[model samples]
Target: MLGELEMVKAVLSGSRRTVVLTGAGISVESGVPTFRGRDGSWKNYRPEDLARPDAFEARPELVWEFYNWRRESLRESEPNAAHLALAEMERKKNNFLLITQNVDGLHCRAGSRKIMEMHGSLWQIKCTKCTHAREDFSPLPPMPECPVCGHLLRPGVVWFGEPLIPGVLRVAIDEINKSDVFLAVETSSLAQPAASFYQLAKDHGAVTVEINREPTPISGFMDFALHGKASDILPELMAGLSE
Candidate 1:
């Protein structure tokens, strides 16, 4: 049997249509905490609870408080080598696409241009009343209002009960359908929609690859599985590709 590196290299060779999906596990190396793991609690509140639309409507200030803290925490952390390597792959591949479930925006920071953020972003905010939105990381105070309509400002993200952004899922699906190789990086493959992507790609006759700390729910279905930290594995894979 080929080792993980050789397998990934072999899979990637001659592949012009590739899609990489990332999750919180990839961002944890940059000091950002995983949402469902160790950094799961904040002031006695679960992130899932606070990240809901009902919760935000109940207390927008409280929601902002948590988001602001999270934003500030990640503001200083730089993208790791894995991030840079992925960005390099994007620069080199003509038909490469990156789909990330992380809200931290590290993929963008790492310079991956063709990206789909499935979970929305921490640095983005929109008005409660209108649709006006822009990238703003300023600390929001009590009753922070929208600039356009003077309404409350909320983090631009897919809340617990909300649907994804209008066109985002379609883009991801389209990419997966057309990709010859689909890499599921650092995600548990348990989350809905995103969890279904690799399987969707496989059904469409694409080679599905899994790179994570452990075997995920979809591991059994993947054509190639590599169990390791993305920080360590991704760079090595990229190196092999370049060689």
Candidate 2:
């Protein structure tokens, strides 16, 4: 196992330009459960079933209810140490790009400036019927109908059957392709395109590194795997980089 101290040293002394891909594991430190875990409160429901356009079409209210709960929960949580560490790294490292599968805005909350929210964000709501969208600071439930179109507003997240936002994905891919180092932070390799992003980074000749508690399907595929909580590991690494 690479010690956190060494990881930071490696990052600071590494080749130019670092690209990061973060996922649910990173947010788990912030008290957000993996929504699909067997013991999870939201376990019975498929995110696909609740997050899809079809679901919104059939039962917009239910979709709103589900997301409302998520929004409320998110409102109560704060960014954790790993989030702050990444944000701090962004400040020190001029060449950094952050791509996250997490819909929570914790990365931004932690002060990371250059971020590509791959799955979209909970802070934004958009109408399915129209191009209408807005950023709301209120913790109001997701039910507020679009004043313009009177259509129900939904969270601006990518559902199971939806393609990633082209602009965001293109930018993330461009950074990944140009990166000298790729960090896959606290992610399960089981997820779809999120999992495939590591492969894309590898194909571009970036050294791929993973930080996770357990071995994932991509464990062997990485140039290195560091087993530990990202909160503990990343801060330690960031401290080393500042030395």
Candidate 3:
């Protein structure tokens, strides 16, 4: 049997269209907190509590505090090797798409142009009472307000029990259905929609690959399961592509 690297490389070499799905694991190496593991708690509250609509509704200031802390933590973090490798892959591939669940903008900072942020970005702010949303990286006040309308502004993230921005999910599925190769990189494969994306790609005749530090629920189903840090594995895979 071919080794994992060889198998993935072979599949990628022959594919015309490729899609990559990523999650929080991809950004861990860059010092961003996973917010699901050991670092998941803040002020005795679990991430689930602060990440829900009810929590924000009950205490908008508290929710903003959590998010503000997260933003400050990620402010100085830089994209790691895995992020750079994927960006390089995008530059080389004629047809490539990146679908990510991470709210952080590391992938964009790494130079990836064709991207779908399934989870809204932390940098984006939306007015609660109007259709006003814009990307801003500047420091925000304790409680931000919309400039367009004097309404409260909230982070443009898809909180728990919230639906994704319209058309994002549809477009992602459409791309996955037509891809020739699909890679799940640094994702836990536990979240809905994204958890099933690899299966969808496989059903549609795409070669499926998983790159993660640990075996996820869908690892056994992939055509090739590469286990390691994406920062390490992706650069090696990129090297194979160049050869």
Candidate 4:
């Protein structure tokens, strides 16, 4: 098998246009619970039900309760070393982009400058009427009202049935299309559209790499597969580039 350092060197020497895609798995190291895990449940509701538009419309209070609890859980969380390593790596690269499926705001906290959040952020809220959005860390009431238009405020997130923000998807696609080095870091490669990026990048003649604790759907197609935690693997990858 090729050594991890060899993989890192190969990635770095491969291209200047690099794109890194991150998912919930990466945040696991920072103590964030996966949405499907045991603690992800609130009351009798499944996580999927709570994140749907119909649920929020029916019982905004209950949905807000889950969100408020999540905020509390996320309040003290810090970015793991993997997130930091990605930020630092981007700094040294000429053209790089970080596309993430997380709403925890950890990538922003880690100082990543060029990022396309595929999902909206938990720290933000959007008005159901107008197109107003802003960071809101305030306590969630049973039904929060949009400060600008007095309309119902929804969590600024791409819920289960919602489409990704068009602009954000465009950027992610463009970055992936142009990248010569594409890293799927801690993602399951199962989220649709985003999941297809590994293939898209490969089709565009990019070197596709997968770094995950276990094999994902596209593992067999990746040019390089590193089975491990990104928290440990990413730093080693960076060190290999420097060596």
Best by TM-score: 3
Question: What lDDT score goes with residue 2 in model 3?
Answer: 38
Q: List model 2 lDDT by residue over 1-243, tens digit each.
A: 556448545755565888888988898878887765664556467666788888888888888888888888888789999999999888877898888899889999999998999888988888868999887768765478887888777888888788988787678778888998888888887777677888898898888888898888998988888888999888877865742
Look at candidate 2 and give me any clashing residue pairs: none
Off by over 4 Å in 1: 240-243
Model 2 scores a C-alpha lDDT of 0.83
In the range 50-162, model 1's lDDT, one tens digit per residue, is 99989988887888888888888988888987788889888767899999998888889999889888878988888888989998767667567888999888888888889
Candidate with more favorable, higher lDDT: 2 or 3: 3
Please list the C-alpha lDDT of all candidates, in the order they appear: 0.86, 0.83, 0.91, 0.86
Evaluate model 3: give its TM-score.
0.97
- Relative to the true structure, candidate 1 reaches a TM of 0.95
Q: What is the alpha-carbon lDDT for the whole of candidate 3?
A: 0.91
lDDT of 4 by residue, 110-225 (tens): 99989888898999888888998889887778788887889988889999989999788887888899999999999877778889999999999998889998888889999988
Q: After superposition, how far is residue 97 of candidate 2 from its true place, in Å?
A: 0.4
Query: What TM-score fits each model?
Result: 0.95, 0.93, 0.97, 0.94
